[model samples]
Target: MTERAIVAGVPVDTRHWIGGRRVASPGTFTTTSPVTRTALAEMSRGTALEAEAAVAAARAAFPGWAATGRAERARILHAVADGVEQRLEDLAAVETHDNGALLRSHRRGVMPRVAHNFRFFAEWLLTLGRDDFATRGHTNHISWDPAGPCVLITPWNAPLMLASWKIAPALAAGNTVVLKPAEWSPLTASLLADIAAGAGVPPGVLNVVQGYGEDLGRALVSHPGVRRISFTGSVPTARRIAAAAAPNLTPLSLELGGKSPLLVFADADLGLAADLAVEQYDNAGQVCLAATRLLVEESVAGEFTRLFTERAERLRPGDPREPGTDLGPVVDARQLERIDGFVRRALAAGARAVIGGGPGTGDSGTGESGLHYRPTLLTDVAQESEIVQEEVFGPVLTLQTFTTEEEAVGLANGTRFGLAATLVTGDRARAARVAAQLVAGTVWVNCFFVRDLRAPFGGSRDSGTGREGGGWSFDFHCDVKNTVTAPKGWRDHG
Candidate 1:
């Protein structure tokens, strides 16, 4: 951690660099404050030439770097952990200021996960090896190795955290990279690139460009030199990345949005589940794995609403960086408008606001200014309500009731998105049965928004394909290169 990195929302540097030298023609763009719409930094957007420079630098370093021993890569990643930990506060503040995400989200959600991800991938790389498999008088030494240069595109919601999800593993797998970050939030990406370069990473191994996805993202993804693309964003954008990847047959891993369901069974712990589920809305339900839909058995819907509303009302919304503020406004004014629009559509179509509803209140998005939305719960929402079908991505939860266990599972799986689900039941048999039947990638028996860097994290259906966290990511970066060989003796012609 350098004292030079110790600053408060200033434009640090703009020249595009490769292997430690600042080069020419770095185009300029201004980064705005999501909180107040003020210009925070004047960044140099990467032109196609600059983008090419990054790709070319990565290409130049690929052979020597990828060919290096995995242990050497691991040591550098291990050093990154110390750098990240030392600068955790700076990172968190910057994330909150740039993305308008909760401050602790970076401290708790991003930082530890970033460190753990680096360490986890470092360990995972050591276990992968090329080995000989002999079968029926034939033998082959299967070689699994790095796939060369990788292009990673991360979302603003969890920028650095998601960056590490791809960055740490791609490096650990021995591939060089050129990362393109969302223009909505590029501070963390730029900071991370600087950190990686400073943390003993040989230059050209990592590159970053700050700009709109349409130009920069397209250039990075469509480039012929990129071997693999790892993207985390919306479904539409993922589709675009897929199309760009089609011509080159570039390997891809997409992690998109979700409309997760939280099923409340008759025999479940209503009080506890309601507390945890709605309590999470303080972060304005921006979490991808949040219980966006509450599907309760008819026998428990009444009880579920009672408990959920009681807890939801207690959550306070205000400035995200503040200590007592549980819920901040959604990321920006656009998101706040979208949240309002989603609720209006639901209300117009015959849904009732059971608890805090309408536009944001208090210090959150005031009637005329800032970005904030009230923690709201909508009941009596038609099963076909837009709120029910689409991801609100705000501090809102829609409710629907089911009669049987089968009905609950059917309703949960009925949506196009299947990212996460929470099943609450006292009986192990019932929990086990329903958890397995759920369509989501992850099913929490009684928990909500819980995560571990060492666990496989991803979704099914429109939520997107591919898994992150753990050593599982190595598969996303490195390809299976099975080498055919025989033991010490020559090719036996016996």
Candidate 2:
């Protein structure tokens, strides 16, 4: 059942993105749905005028929320996980509707992924490691203290899950958050405040502000009270956000774009390689970890191409909620234009369509009902081709063949984006060795885009800074302070 959201009734303000209860000013912004380009709902746009408002709310709540013991904060996150379990259906529907992800994956795949995140962070509280070092019985204990108020700017590709990536751990580590979801997908962010309330989180501890990047984001990033930021999006935007937060010296954890590679060696199971290739683009290749680059061994390139192309073309693109829908629409119109433009330029530069290289549609009328793009594949792309080098964040994938294992690794790491890579090989030793050499934060062998919440996930190089999940995320939200109490006769001066 698709949830027709009553924005006002959701307990969080539809007009405002929840600066906190008994709060929020008169200013607001209207977010339209990509499915219809019609008004979905209106939420607070949060201008710089409200900069004081957001900062005040976060500042007011910061001391109490931060001072609360880690156990209490972890309990709140546990409660959030429980609430997610109870309203999984509602939240899933909201995600599918607002973000246009295939319900099949959003329900079974993404939601479970989110549940795992909350659970993983929640479980970290138990047996939480504290840094204590001993030298000559002069114990030096390191205390983890919250960095105070935080602002999370999440992308539309996986708003709820990514927000959970920021939200769960921040809460677990005793940091209050004010997240601004992509205006293209504000519905779920709107619901987050309600979910937190149900989980017994106090008002102002979690806030959601919706507006365009130029305005609301500027306000949030430049706000004085915010001590840190956790963002997942594009490099350009990350740069801008980083610049804005610079003067304040606010720490940030940024997870920005990728042009990931999927290597299929001659020894890889052809059927499995085909399966991974096809599944890799199912999210309309919106995933930052999407295997948009296919590096195949020349010996088996033909077989891999034949099998993978067949699966890619056969994908039925339609309403994500519809049955048997293998792929759905892109996120919005601008993304559609950008993705298609990249594909066109690639073709003009001599690339050829391998399997699918067309457009897809969405729900009944209005061709632009939802942002939809066809699953496209291109061959004959050069190493320096823009499509190969740039982050073509769509269902468009490029196919290339490499002869040697060294060549495969070389081509895979050639990109400036070092977010993720995939290797499909049956030789366990070679696969392990290649996976090690690949310059990516995460690598999948024989599979792609498999995420475990307990794993330490992050990127290297320009893919942006800091790790999320596991113990690393806890540290991302808190700074360690060493308490050195001198024992008798322990003074170095003596």
TM-scores vs. true structure, each candidate: 0.92, 0.93
lDDT of 2 by residue, 219-305 (tens): 899887888899898999999999999999999898988888999988889999988888778678888888889888999989888
For residues 225-271, what per-residue lDDT tens digits would candidate 1 score against the true structure?
99999988889999999998899999888888888888888888889
Q: Look at candidate 2 and tell me the lDDT of residue 44.
A: 59
Question: lDDT scores for all predictions?
Answer: 0.77, 0.79
Model 1 lowest lDDT segment of ten: 1-10
Q: Give the Cα error of residue 199 in candidate 1, in Å.
A: 1.2
By TM-score, how accurate is candidate 1?
A: 0.92
Question: Candidate 2 at 475: error in angstroms?
Answer: 1.2
Show model 1 residue runs off by greater than 4 Å.
1-11, 14-19, 23-26, 130-133, 137-140, 279-282, 362-369, 486-494
Q: Which candidate gets the maximum lDDT versus the true structure?
A: 2
Q: What is the lDDT of candidate 2?
A: 0.79
List where candidate 2 sits over 4 angstroms from the true fold: 1-13, 17-19, 22-28, 361-370, 489-494
